[model samples]
Target: MAAEMSLVSVVLFIATGALVFFLLFLFAKRQIMRFALRSARKPHINIGADAPRELREEIQRRLTIVQSVRFEPTLLSEQVLEASKSVPNHYLHRMKALDAFTNAVDCLRSKDTTIGLRGTKQTMQLYLFTLCPSAANSSQAQIIDMFCSSYNHARHHPANFGNAELTNYMELLDKVIRMIKDNKKRRAAALYPAVETEVRLRRDCGKRESAETVRHTGKSNNLRLQARRNQPAASRPEHVEQFNMVDKSSGYSSTDHSSSGRGSVERLISPQHSFKPERDEAV
Candidate 1:
């Protein structure tokens, strides 16, 4: 009986050992799976369409603000007729555009020029290049170049910044803000076609007023000349009638200097001096 109990004890010990080993194996497997999941998994961030409504609206508003800002008389305007010469209408870079737009508005409104100034400076360079071909000579371009040099040195040679003073690029920031504001105003004005029409009407009215003034002045001068010639009042009408006559007179006949003075004055405004923005280039 003692031998039988000993065998049973051995069997029971082996079974308990097996159970413990199985439990240990399962625990180890669970631990390994947990580790793998933690290492391989990444936190998901909802963005774009998946982002919240408020976040989307804010982003849209910022984008619209930047889009409203325009650089007039740009290379785009000069070659507007040719599709081949067209520059794609878009911001310089996406991330940079967002940062700069936000910073510029903050800088102007809240006077916050702490962060995002670097991005703003770079955006200005893009703006200059797009708006004007002679961007290299612009004051903003010079400032940005200096900023780039300092930034590179500080980034690559950190030891050199120990005694170096932190450069203030707020002036360039100011320039960026100013340009954006000016552009916004210009674009806003352009939105109202009535404003342009009113301006044209005013210009036409001024031209008519000036012409009437010139005409009255010429009439008075002609009367003075007739009076000087001691012509009778009846003959004055004849002289006035002659002045009013068209160039349909005899061949190569000299025009009356006083009467034709308006045409001469008008001719002084040469076509060469007028603005002609069209360019000659095509595929």
Candidate 2:
């Protein structure tokens, strides 16, 4: 279907063998993308070990919020994977994205800094993304320029950090991450209908029909064709002769021949023998 996933974490699975399609909604994709944009910008707060120990710790703690915001809580059972094996590449892509989300979250949780300090890369990005995501949807150059602009503004204006208190920041982070987790759960639930429907469709589309079943189905069709008639056998209509098949041995069809009425039949058989093609069988 060529459905784009760049707009959101909407991973679409276009069918290859049958009429079916599905999507995987990973909330992490958007955050991960914005994170990349923020990272690509040259200027960001990098509190090295030589910097004040307190400042480094604070920065590390705040980093956890960024990672948490990017976390994806989508964990499907093996059944979903097996049921959707037809699109292995897309399934694998979703798994890879999930893994990336996990790793990002882990790295951030290992941090000791609090969130929202002047000149912090992730702080401004997260706040901006949460409030205005269109800024990150631009080209790489534009996104980098936007990040640089935000960084310079925050560097001079400490209030630009959004929130700096440890408890308030954690609470706000918790709310944002909770919403993200809930959204992911809803997306995960949506997978069930697609998986179940595709599996059922595969069965209904007769992909697993046995050769015997196919033969039997064809036989039944032939029988139905045989029993069907243009008119009642007892009251056969004269016009019916136009549609009847001709005997090839006569070197002519029942129509477009000089013979009229039963003469056409006599061409295929002796006049002494009456034609009796109509038959019925107890189905």
Candidate 3:
């Protein structure tokens, strides 16, 4: 009876151990599945499209305020063409001087003078200043002419900018006129026989290209023109016009300086001052 009782105790201990082992296995399995699910789950994301309307509008208002406070012309394109021509970023500052010039009409014609008008007018005073024309852009004078026209309009259709905005504008215009005239005249004075006020445009063109480029450019131009002199005279009237200096005595004779001036530019560019010597390159 003692032996049987001892054997029963041993059997009961084994059964309890097995049950504990089974429970531990189930717990481990449950933990592993939870970990896997967490690993597979996508991360939570909150996109603007899913945002409330009020939040979106507040965000947009902040953007507008930031843009209005543009300390620089960051909104404009980087002007890759100018950059490629070795123009400097420093030249961009001159655009501020031209700002009022570009937006002369809008500055003179403040649409809503009663609300945010000072900011509007001040902004307009130099509106186009951010796009300072290159020296090659001969139309800088034309822009000033536009400003003068706007000034006339303001004179006739007068509105009050109580803080002397109009008065300030006139003063600024006078200053700009004097500054441009003085600077151009000073530049002209340095050259032989002085120079004409009409031809001197006080534009902020960048530094000169390297001397090698200038020398090669001259040689290339002479060679190219000599080649153009060789093409059959009347193959194209435009080409004939280009060589007015050389083709006038030839078959293509027409007294139209206007067509020659414009067409000559097109022809020159199309050739790049370096036309290939072969017919294939021309083709």
Candidate 4:
């Protein structure tokens, strides 16, 4: 009886130990499965869409404000030396502004919806401000004209565009204008004769071109007037007659004549006079 009891106790102990081991194994498996599930169920990173509407609008507003603040041509000329000295260092600031403008434009273009009128105007203003010269004085106009020509070349010509930089666009303009102004200041200097000669040549060329354009415009306008006049009074459309009458009323006179056996006509008109009648009639 004593031996049988001892054997029974030993069997019970072995069974208890086996049960504990099984429970531990089950717990470990459950924990491993939970860890794997957690690892597999991670959240994704979010890279949101383009700039928000509010931010874009704010940028556009700022751009408009910047555009309206016109630079004074006389002040710019007076401070040319100072601008030259500061430009190299402050170039990065200008570049940052340019980048902001570019990014804003990109955001504006990305949307399928039409930008509001205000937004469109602001964008155009920003583009002009960043890319065009300030409209302050006649000097500024000349600088702007040159800058525009350069910009067109840059856009169309790969070599020119490659050499172009934001700083180059901004600073070079001021530099060239300053150099011209400085040359004018030193007109009595030893280099004055050569510089004056170049200036005179440029001035003459500009005047000649302007005169040619005026002559061509006048000839074309005269031809148009003559054709309208030659139209039989019955064939003269009401609008054409009205237009001619308005032109005559507003200081524009048309003369029909014959030159070298060819019918020649002349029309003397001012743009202001031509447009004013139409505007007044509309109003």
TM-score of each: 0.22, 0.17, 0.18, 0.20
Clash count for each candidate, listed in order shown: 0, 10, 9, 0
| Global lDDT scores for all candidate models | 0.38, 0.35, 0.37, 0.36
Model 2 ranges off by over 4 Å: 1-104, 107-164, 189-283
Give the candidate order by descending lDDT. Answer: 1, 3, 4, 2
> In model 4, where is the ten-residue run with the lowest total lDDT?
262-271
Q: Which stretches of candidate 1 lie over 4 Å from their true place?
A: 1-28, 40-107, 110-174, 186-283
| Candidate 3 structure lDDT | 0.37
Q: Which candidate would rank higher by lDDT, 2 or 4? A: 4
Determine which window of 10 residues in candidate 3 has minimal summed lDDT: 212-221
What are the per-residue Cα lDDT tens digits for candidate 2 across 1-283?
Answer: 3345543333322342123321223446667877987888544545555788888888788876774554334444456546545653323323322333333334333441222222334544444333222222322213323333433433343432332222222222222232332233333332323321111223336566433221111111222222322325454323322211323234223233443443222232222222222232234
> By TM-score, how accurate is candidate 1?
0.22
The digit string of per-residue lDDT tens for model 3 on 1-283 reads 9999999999999999999999999999999988877887543442355779999888667866874563423222336324624853432222322333333323323432211223433533232221122211233433443444444444333442222333333333533333333333322332224222322233345754433211111111123223433546464233122212233122211223453333221222222221121222232
How far does residue 43 in candidate 3 sit from its true spot (Å)?
11
